[model samples]
Each structure stands twice: as structure tokens, then as C-alpha cells.
Target: MSFLLRFIAECLFTVYSVSFLLYHRRNFLMKQNHLIFFLISAVINWSFSATWGLAISSHYGAPALLLIVLLELKGLYQMNPMQLLFESGYFVAVLYWGRGIVLPVFALILNQSVHWVRHNRFYYPVAWILSLCMILVYNMLFRHVIAPKAKVETFYRSKEQIRFVAIFQVCLLGYLLFINLGRYYGVDLPWYKISHIISCIICFAAQGLLVNRGIRNSSLLEYELHTELLQQQLERNLRHYKAYQKYAESFRAFKHDYNHMMTSVKSLLSAGEYQKAINLLDTIHETRHKQVPVQHSYSNNNLLDSILQDTANRCEEQSTQFSANVYLPAGHNISDIDIVRMFTNLINNAAEACAKVTSDSERFIAITSRFISHNGWLQIKTANSFHGKVLIRNGIPESTKPNRDFHGLGLSIIDETATKLGGIMVIDVDQKEMVFKTTLLLPVNIQQWNKKDRLPVRGG
Candidate 1:
């Protein structure tokens, strides 16, 4: 009965530890039908422990650990063997360290000496209870405090990390198996205990190194994000200043033309040529309107307005025909920087494409945005004409222009923005029509739409 109880307790502890580590690594096994997975895990754990006990002379947990590593390859975790092994080994190491500290307290509570604790019938059961409590506390601390501030991907994303960890774990496992086999053979060497302690310290040091590296990576990632945001803000402000200047110029031109128009109108009226006066007024109105530059309003969202205005100004300078029909609903919840990044990249790519066209009459860019899917999604589309071939790989366009190092980031930037905003971007090219189009869709919560202020500007 004692042996049976110990076996059951060991199996339970191993499953709990593996599952906890997997959850922290974002495997989230318990997300779907917890009871079913738990049952399956229990069966596997029992079989694993039984197989080790029946054949392997109780080699502390080497065979059992190896079995778990093999099983995880086919498990629902979606991790490679080395990654799974590292996670499992780390969990085991942490639990062993915790047990080394807490099991003595248990021994004292049970009125037994520390040496007697290991040989006692209740040793495994007590260890199981203590390990479970420790695992729970560590899981909470890892998820809430440590993980939020660290880059977990920095450790797992590199193949070098996997190879290093795998090699270290294999060495540790080999040493452990050797020591346990020596004990099974009644070869109680003094160095066995010393080697075990040294190995524990090494494992602790390795884990500490991993944690430090992850923190450093997280800091670097945050710094890069901050720098990118500052650049975007600077660009947005510059565009706003330019748009204001253009508006002022257009207002001044209209004001100057107003007096001349009044004088012409009065003279025509005095001649009593009613039809001619009407015709002259119409002609004057058309001429004044043409003389003043048209400032187009694209959206009620001010951020979108600024970006569109900037793009329109660029098109005008290039003598390209530009048309925009954009309506961003009131109370749009997206951040200004993300809006700037996404639209800026899209429009910049379009402008560059249209500028290369030799025929000025054929060069054109069009932009449109609307709330689609019953306001649950925002769809933005841009179309422009191009003269050269567009190279696309993995749905990403490669830069065809000179200075490839400096020019290929436009679409990548847009792709990153779309991913951040829970959106997708599609790029399409019509070879015969020489038209390149991009469509972006983002999930959004929009309250209302206001399209009355939209100005459709067409450049001659």
C-alpha cells in the first residue's frame, strides 16, 4: 500500500509540474476540455512511472524524465523536442531545489530527522504536497510579475539557445543517470553527493543567465518601439504644419480674387445684358475656383485628415492625379501613431510607384477607406499606376529601386502595423492595366460617421 501510494503521488506531481510549465510557455493545454486532458495525462504519467519502476531499478527519475520528453514531442504543446525538454528539465530542477529546502521542514514537522525523511514511507507524499504548493506560487509569480517585464521570445526564438540548452540538459541527465545507476548497483561513492550538489548549482546558474538575457532583450525591444514612435510623431507634426500653410495660401488667393470678381459683376449688371451678365458671373466663378488650390478633407478623424492632406500635396507636386474618398467614423478608437504609420506607408508606396510613370497624364493614385462588415471592420484601399515590374515573394513586395537597403521597409512597416491592429493587408497588381492596389482591413469599434466635410480634390 505504501509503494502504491508513493507511485500515485509521484505520477500526480510529475503531471502537475509538466502542465504548469507548459501553461507558462503559452501552450495552454487546459484551455479545451480540462478533464479529458487531465485523464490522459494521468494515464501517461502512470504508465511512464510504472515502466521505469518495473525495468530501471528506480534510477531516480532519469527514465521517467526521458519518457516525458518523448511524449511531449507528440503532445499538444506544438514545441520541438529540445524546447520541451528544456522546459521540463527546468521545471524538474526548480521542483528539486524547492524540495531540497522544504522537505527538511516537513521532516521536522513530522518529528523525524532530515536523514530519516528520505527513507520514510511518507517521504514521496510529503514531497508531492510541498512541490505542488511551490509550483503554484512560482507560476503566479512568473505570469504576473516576471513574464510581463521580460521577453520570453528572446530565449526561445533562437536556434542557438535551443542547441545550448539541449546540450547542457543532456549532459546533466547523463550524469544523473550514472549516479543513480551507481546507487542501484550498491556503489555508494562519496563523490556522488558532491557531484549532485555541483550539478544543482550549475543548473541554477544557467537558468539565471537565461532570465538575465530575456530582460535585456525586453529592454532593447522597448527602446526601439519608443524611437519609432518619436519618428512617427515628428512626421505627423511636419505634415500638419505643411497642410496649415497650404490652407493659408489658398485662403489668401481667394480673398485677393474676391474684389476683382465684384467689380466685373457690377459692370456687367450695369450694361443691362442679363444673359451676358449671368454668363460672365459663371465664367468668373469658374476662374476663381481654379486659381485657388483645393484642400481636400478625407476623414472626420483629424489624424487621418493630416496624413491624407500630406499625400495629396505630394501628388500635386508630382503632377499626378489624386482622388481620395475616406470616411473614418467619429470616436475611432485607434491610436494616432498607428494610424500615421499604416497610412503613411501605404500612401508613400503609392506615390513612389506613380512617380516613376513617364506619362504624366497616366500617373494617378486613388485612396478610399470605409467601415465595412457592419462597422466591425475598417477597410482601407489604395490604387496607383506603375511602369515597372513588381517583385513579390511570400506576399511581400521586394524593392525594385536603387539603394535596396534603405527602401524595402515601407510594406514591412505596413504589415507590422496591420498585425498590431488585428488587421490584414492584401497587395494586388494588374499587369495589363499597370495598376497596383493594396487593401487593408482592421477590426474596429466605430460609433458614427460624418462624410459632409469630405473634400474631393483633383489636380490638373
Candidate 2:
């Protein structure tokens, strides 16, 4: 009976731990077949604990189990190895603390409660109610209250924060193990057990408070950084808008003077002063070309057109040739902010790559978009010339900038935005031609596009 109870308990704990871990990592695992691997790992973990007993299994069998879980996570998520290790270690710490401390304390409480109640018939029902209440509280606090404040991605990415939590859990586990050892040695000190359990509870509460505070601080820092970036983008947009306004004003002035210039040219021609007429015609042509530069209309979406024009202007300033043929129509499901983010990152990366080419003629950036009417998919492609080798890790090109942690987030931001919009991004590099290209495909409403939405392609 004891063996059966132990085996059942181990199985339940394994399933619970795996479920908790999977729930915490749902964002990363949603698109993958992670359930089967986790289920298999849980079964193996239960088998190990049932066969070898909790004592040997936790100490000796844990490393093997950790290795298996890490391998499964790596194969599925393609996360950094160091991050994987930290995640796996954190899981082990949580599992160890739950099994070693919380479960034992609950069992002790229940055992003591049965003696006080005298009527054993009500025990199972009471236990069931208590279990349900605990689960409800746990979910309400962790899922609803805490999760929004401390997003899983943000929490996991901060190595130091996770490391601190893991260490605290380990310390609590050690303290509980020591208490358990005293009980094993025939120490009949129930008060001592209760006191230690109380201490552990307080410690756990303190740890939770610390973690919450840390997460809040991290969130505040991220918000501030994001706000700064938005301010910078707003300033750039204002500059672009002002430049466009000036260009429009100059074009209007040219239009107002057109009739007078034409009349003057006709008069000069009628008088038969052939050389003077030719000079006057040449002067008018120069004035028209200088004042009314060709205005580009790359897309039906005003915001997208502005972004393209801004990028074009930046590229021109850097002596990099820029070309674009975009046709994004209005009234699409994609938000304007998301479109801005995706296109801005894409063009900026292309321009940066173009800047690396030594030969002026070879430096070029090209962007185009096509709507596949049949599939309701919009494909955007950017191609540019680059001079050096591009190192790609886990499908993302590593940033060549000195401050890699801060500078390399553009691609990730674009990729994340694409993913949020039910899209996929692909990158290709041609070593022979020294060209790098990025392609993004996003789902859009077919009704949003029409023949009038088409725009002529232009190159500089």
C-alpha cells in the first residue's frame, strides 16, 4: 500500500510539475509540438522516482532528467544554451522545493488534523475542498495577479533575477531537508517542525515580494527606454514631414509660374530670335527641374509612404541608391504602428548594410511589396549590398555592432511584429553578389486591395 501510494504521488507530482512548466512557457511552445516531449519526459521522471525512491532520485537521478529536459527544450525552442541551462536549473529548484518542503508540510498538517477531527469519514471531502481552494488561490495569484506584471519572456531573459530566485528556492529546500533529517532521527519535536514551516512560509512570502519588486523595476526601465525611442522616432517623423511640406510648397510655386513661363517662351519663338528662344526654354526647363523634383508615391497608405520616403532620403544622404515599389492599401487588419515598426526596421537594416559597401555604385537598397490576391498574403522584400560576412545564429543575423545587446534588437522587433500579425520572415544572403535580402509575408484582407492601389516602381 505504501509503495502504491508513493508511486501514485510521484506520478501526480511529475505531471503537475510538467504542466506548470509548460504553462509558464506557453508563449514559446505554442507553435511547436512540445506537449508530447514534455509528457514523455514526465513519464521518465516519474519512473525514475518510483523505482529509485525520492531520496536517491532527487540527488542522483535529477542530473539525467535535467539533461533530457534541456535537450528537448533546445530542440524545440532553439534558445541560447546558457538560457536553457538557467531555465532547466530554475525548474529543478522549483520541483525540489515543492516536493521537499510544501508537500511534506501539507501532509503533516493533514495527519495532525485527522487526530483532532476524530470522525475520519469527513476527511476525504475536506481534503478535496482544501485542495480545490489552494489551486484556485494559486492560479488567481500567479496567473492573474502576478503574470501580467512579470511576463514570462521578461522574467526568463533576466538571468540574474532568475538566478536569485533559484538560489532562494534551493536555500529553502536545504532548510526543509534538515528539518526532515531531524524527524528521521527520532526527534519528537512537533513544535520545531511547525516553527520551521512557519519560517519557510515567511521566507517564501519575502521571496515573492522581492521578485515582484524586481519585475516591476525591470518593467519600468523597459517602459522608459521604449518611451525614449518613441520620442526619437517622433522627432524624425516631424523632420520628414517638414521636408515634405517644403517640397510641396516649392512644387505649388512652380505650378503657379508655369503659365507665365509658357507665354514668355511662345512670345520668344514668334519673334524668331532662335538663340534667345532656346536660352529662355533652357532656363524654364532648369527652373522646373530644380524646383519641382519628382515626388514619389510608393504606397496608398500615407504613413507607409512617409516611412519609405524618409528611408529614401536617409539613404540618399549616405550616397546609397534607394528604390521602392510598395502597395499597401488602407483599411487593413494590421495596425499602422505595427506597419511602421516593421517597415522602419526593414529599411534601416538595409540602409545600414548598404553603408558597408566601399564602392559607391555597388551600394544600393531595394524594397518591394506584392499582394498575393489568391491567398490574401502580402509579401515585402528588401535587398541590399553588404561588404562582410554575416553571421547567423538560430535564423537571426547577429549584429555586427559593438554594443550587441542593445543594437541587435531591430531584427527581433521586426520578427516579433511579423509573428504577432500571423506572418513569417525569411532572410537570404548571396555571397557571390554580396547581397542580403529579407522577405516578410503577412496575412491581410483581400478586399483591402484593388487595381487603383498599384504604384509605379522608382529607383535612385
Candidate 3:
């Protein structure tokens, strides 16, 4: 094919890649701006790629592809230099082992330099100078002036080269995923081939969307977390506000009683009946306990407190037994929303599950939470009593009956939260009891992992 035709084909594929990224809305995952930054990113990648085509061989497209991928990864995982280096190293290693895969690997390596320059701004000239030097060095090493280009192409295009490269690519990705497997769903295995293909597709889409959306993952995650924190702050403040309201109401009632008592006391003094006014004050003091329900000692934020209290109240109203023991640390690293959602979803689920029982004794729900270590690893287990067949024995809950869109997402949400916190959740059923347990690396464990690698560092 003519050089012009080949260039056009590359352009087509590049455009396709960018378009796919937009459609997938990878940037939308973090709620990013949709115009300026994304346009700048796209123009930069393609412009540099076009420049490479003009200055170097048209084959420089490989590096362009790699450059885009690195930029995309930066957007996806919020990787720093060291982390980028590690990921690039892993990616390139996969390429290197495949022999003919050197072109793509070299492309990826070139991308590391390009991406660094793109972000650092001041490093642009350095990237170009280094890139030029690399091109010259590669030209000399291959002795392209002496050896025919056909021979090099022949070596790379061999059947064994293709197969080995494919194998290496597969293995590289599979290993990265394997490392993260326990961080996701329970102990269930992932289908590597399917996952890799899907992930690649998603990555392709993510890159383009990132360009269009002007999204940087780290910035976006920070923003999201900030928003959630604000929401919690508002909710906490709202709780305090309500407590103040209750106090205000109690104060007003006391003021009215005082005026009425003063008048009554004078009348009583005239009648010489002093005991009645004293009895009135005593009566208000006696009813105070009933007016204000007992507050749990574990702080107002103890997630299960409200749920348990509500449950107990309902049980009293219906004459049923409801017992609960929730022991969880306060102001821990876990987010309030996650704990709130988990407690609300799980307990409500259990409550509804047990409500179907006809007999009052059998209708009870027992909940307990404790920190347990299996193999000396910290985990929290919550078990509830239920009747009838257990629907989900494995951590994964089965599909809710048709048209119930929200039911299945509860457990799925639980699984997702557990995974995000780098924890595992399991659901097991025995006789009439359904137990859901999730073990998160105590916040300390996360700190330890962060210590293993410094923040904002990417590996090349």
C-alpha cells in the first residue's frame, strides 16, 4: 500500500479509538468537565502522533498508540510516576517477551516519555530530544543503512513471533488481574480471557472519553470523596439540629409548666395545699426517660443504633422478640455512607425476611457483630435468623424476581463497597440462618499498603 493510504488507515483507527472512548464515558465515571481539557488532550495526542509520522517512519504509530494508553491510564487509575513506571514496565515486559512485540513495547516506552512531557510541560523539549536520540540509536543498532528493512520485517512477522507475543500479552494482563482478584468479589475466580478482552474494550473507550471529558482520575476521585464528605457533614449537622429542636420543645413546655405552677402554688398557698405543686414537678421528672429513648453509648454514628432502635420499637408495637448486639469502632476509616447503607440494606433485608413468619417466636431476627480473625486477619461478621430456603449461599445474590430493579443492586452494592475498601464479603446459609460477613483490612492495613509505595508515584 502507498504511504498516503497507510497514513489514512492509521488516522481512521485513531479516530475510531477516540470515538469509542467518548461513547463509554470513562470520564463521566468521575463526573468530569466535557469539553476543554478533553479537547486539549485529544489534540495533543493526535498532533504529536501526526508529527511523529512526518518526522519518523510511519511505523511510529505504535508509539502513538502507547502514548495515548499511558495518558488514559493516568486518567483511569490516578497513577504517579513510579506507579506509571511499574505499569509501563509490566506492559512492556509483556511486549518484550513476545519478540516481534518489540514494536508495540517500544511504542509504549516512548509513550512514557511523551506522557511525562505532556503533564510536566517544561519537559517537552527533553522528551523530543530524548526521542530523537532514541530513533537515531535504534537506526544505528539495526544498521538499517546496511541491513534490508525486508529482513527485519520478515523476522517480526513470523508465525511463532505472533503466537508468542499473544501469549505474553495474555499472561501479563492475567497476572495484574490476579493480584487484584481478592480485592474484588469474594474468592470466586475471574475469567481472564473474557475479562482482558472486555477491559481492553473499556480502556479504549475510556481513553477517548477521558480526552473528551477532560478528566483526571485522581482529581475526580478527590472531588467525589469531598462531595460525599459534605453530604455526611450536612446529615450529621442535621441530626444535631433536630436534637436542638427537641431540647427547645422541652424548654418551652417547661416554661409553660412553670407559669402554670406558679399560679397554682399561690392558689394552693391560699388553700394551704402545698403538696400538689411538688407532685407536678416530680411527675415531669419521672416521665423524662420515656420521652427520650436511651441513647446508645457507641456515639450517635454507631450505624446499627438507629436500625436496632427502630426494630425494637416495631417489635414492641407488634409483641415480637428482636435482639441485637452491634460492636463496631467509631470514627474509623470507613465512610459513614457505606456503613449506613450497609446496615440499612442488610438489616432491612433481614427484617423483611423474618417478617414473613407466621409464629411470633419464629419471627424473631437476631443480629450480632464482632471483630474476628481467621488466620489472624480482621473481619466483621453479621448473622441473622431466617426461615425458608436460603437464596444466596455464595457471596453473590441471585437475580431478584423479574422487574425488581433495586433488590439485586443492594448486595451488589455491598460487594462493590467491600471491594473498594479492599475487603471481601461472603454469604453463607445454614438451616434457618443466613449469614453475611465481610472482612476489610482494618484502616491500618490500608495505611500499610500505602506505605509500601509512596503516594502519587507511578512505575515505568
Candidate 4:
């Protein structure tokens, strides 16, 4: 009962891992890269496990079996069903004095690779002969079964040893399947080459299925990493946007009050309250001075804030006055994952560029974003100060710094996100002011936004 439970546990673990792999990289099964990965795992599992089962009954006996079950559950790649069963059967046969059987899967691989794998003169024959000799020696010397493990080996042996070992393996496969035929399809054929061939074909299919699965697993891992990056970027972008929005609103209020104050001053001048108006104007200047120390924060999302703060802090440590504004859309139109990719890469790029300068004041950046006319379209702009010439082309900075082989790619990321959203990207540079600006249209499909570039640019 314990054994049955263990077996189920291992099988389920392996299935779970494969399932997770399939989910993460749902498209990987369609690619050929996974095929190579599975083959590599198969080769490793087959050679080691089979050798263990032969030498020590305990290798697959109790504790090791439990571990294997756990490992299978954990989804670590290992031996397939056919390899495990056939190898255990072979060990039993070798221990109890029966005809030498071998792993026919290895035989097929050898037959295919013997001529091509560098004409290994001491190869195929030597391998099987050595395998048989080791078992026979264990039987003769110790008078019991002993499994053999080679540091490196594959079943595709060369033309050096006796050819009969290959035949023995093929026959063994046939015999094993013939005995178990009742468990599968109801074909009542006797155990022979034909039966073995059918099983081998099934083995091939299994291998293919596994390879596709592995590829999918790899792909899933890759995408999961991407989703994480995207999530971080989005938070950063949103934070930068919200800060700008607050600043815009506050400044608008301040300006409205100033206009009223200006009207009062004009009336005071007409009524000959000139000294009062002068005193009022002086108070206004002081008030505006207090407000003029304008502060704009970058990001508010902690997940995103960490990235921006770390980079901005690094820039400040290098003496750059780095400031950014983030604004999240009113509703959850964009997935959080995609947003992460945009801001993480963008903010990192901005900090790196600012950090390159030597002069303290030369290093500076300002990031701002807003929705166009309360519409769904988001407009992002990042401006940074630099000392040297700004050679920007088509919204990408062509670096003037020598010795580096690569040019701009960060903007490329923003451009890519924008493109995916069906929007355009723009960049501007003022060499005289030592400023670089990047503008991107956030992909928000607002009902108020016209697709025909006919929206008004409001100051608010």
C-alpha cells in the first residue's frame, strides 16, 4: 500500500511539473528546441538509473524509491516509464540467471549513430560486451547480482563487440511488451520483432511528446520572467504619471488665484490704492516664491517605486537632480504585467544616461505623463540634461560616447510597447539647453480620443 502511494506520488509530481511547464510556456511545444532538451535528460536518466538497479536492489528498493517519487512530484526530469520498468526487469533477469537483456532504446540510438559518431572502432561491440562481462563477473565473483555504472555511455554501441547483444536487446523489448500486452490494446500478437517494433514506435511517440513538453516548460519560464519585468515597469510609469497630474492640478489652482489677485491690483490702481496694491504685489511675490520650490515625485506603487527610487538615488549619488512623474489610468484597462516592462526598462535607462555625466549640474532628468484631454490616450515625456552633443535619430538616442559597441535600445522598448498598443512615439532634443525628451502615446482607447490625430492639446 505504501509502495502504491509512493508510485502515485511520484507520477503526480512529474505530471504537475509538466503541467506547470506547459502552462507557463504554452507555445513551447510547437518549437523544436524542447526536443533536444528532453533527449539530453533522457540520456542522463536512462544510463544512471538502470546501472543502479542492477548493482544494488536498494537503489530502486525503498528509500531511493521514495526519493524518486518525491523528485517526480517536484518535476525534476528523470527516467521514463518504459526505461524504469525494462531496466528493473533486466536487473531481475541478470540476478536470477536468465538470458542477457539490454535497453533496446539504446540499441536503436547506437544503430543510428555508430557510423556517424566518429567511426568509434572500439565503440558499440565493446560497450555491450563490457556491460555483459561486468554482470557476468559480478555473478561469478560475488555469486550475486551487481549493476554497473559507466561515467559516460549511450546504448548506440559500435562495430567492435559481438553483434548478438543488439539482437538480445531487441528480443528483450519484444518479450517484455508481449507479456504486458493485456494491459494495453487488446491485440493478441505473440512477443517478437513486430511486437517490439510497435512498442519502440510508441516509445518514440512518448519521447516526442516529452520533448514538446520540455520546450513548453522552457518557454513558460521565459514568459514568467517577462511578466515580472513588465509588472515592475508599469508601476514605475504609473507613479511618474500621477505625480505630474497632482502637479498640474495644484499649479492650475495657484494660477487661478493669481488671476483674481491681478484683477484686484488693477482695481486698486484705478481707485488710487497704489501703495496697497504695491504691498499686495509684494505679498504675492513672496507667496509664489514659497510655492516655486516645485517638487514632483516619480512613482507611488511600492513595487515600481523601489526600481525608480533605487535608480534615481543612484543618479543623485552621482549628483544628478532626477525627478519623475507617474500617473495610472483611472480604470484597469492595461494589465499590470505589461506596464512593468515599460517603466522598469525606461527608468533604468534614464538613470544610466544621467549617471554618465561628470559635472554635478549637467546631470538631471524630468519625467511627466498625462491623459490627452481626459481621453484614454496617455502621453509620456521624459526629459534629461546632458553636457555633450545629442545625436538623436527617429526617437532613439545615437550615443556620442566612444568605445561602446551598442547604441540605444531602451527607447526601443517604449516604442515596442507603444506599437503593440497601436500608438506612435516621438523624441526631441535641444542641444543648446542640453535636454532630451521622449514622448509616447499610452495605449488607452478613450471614447473622447479621435483616432485621426484631431484632439486638442489642453493646458490642464
lDDT (10s digit) by residue, model 4, range 352-431: 66766677867787766777655567787877776667655433565554522122334555665676677767877787
Q: Specify the highest-TM-score model's number.
A: 2
- How do the candidates rank by TM-score, highest first? 2, 1, 3, 4
Clashing pairs counted in every model = 0, 0, 21, 31
Q: Residues 229-331, candidate 2: write the lDDT tens digits.
A: 5664676679768988888999889978987888888898899887887898888889988997777776667677777777778888888888888877543
| Candidate 1 off by > 4 Å | 14-18, 21-46, 53-140, 148-195, 205-209, 265-291, 311-326, 337-368, 372-460
Q: lDDT score, residue 111, model 2?
A: 54
Residue 311 error for model 4, in Å?
A: 3.2
Candidate 2 local Cα displacement, residue 214, angstroms: 5.5
| lDDT tens digits, residue span 1-460, model 3 | 3445435534643453355345324211322454554566567656754554322212333344445655654564333333333333333322222212222233344554222323343333333334334333432442333223323222222223323333444354444335324323442223432343355444333323322232233234334544654564456456645755776787667667768766876787778676876776576666555454444332234344544555555565655566665544332356767775565556556666666656676565555544332222335554555556655522444443463333444554566567566665667666534333333333323322221321221111
The best candidate by lDDT is: 2
Root-mean-square deviation (CA) per prediction: 7.9, 5.4, 20.6, 19.3
Model 2 weakest 10-residue run by lDDT: 113-122
Which residue window of length 10 is worst by lDDT in model 4? 151-160
- Candidate 1: minimum summed lDDT over ten consecutive residues — where? 49-58
Show model 3 residue runs off by greater than 4 Å: 1-244, 251-285, 290-320, 323-331, 371-379, 432-460
User: Model 3 shows how many backbone clashes?
Assistant: 21
RMSD of 1: 7.9
Residue ranges of candidate 4 with Cα displaced over 4 Å = 1-297, 300-302, 393-395, 399-407, 445-460
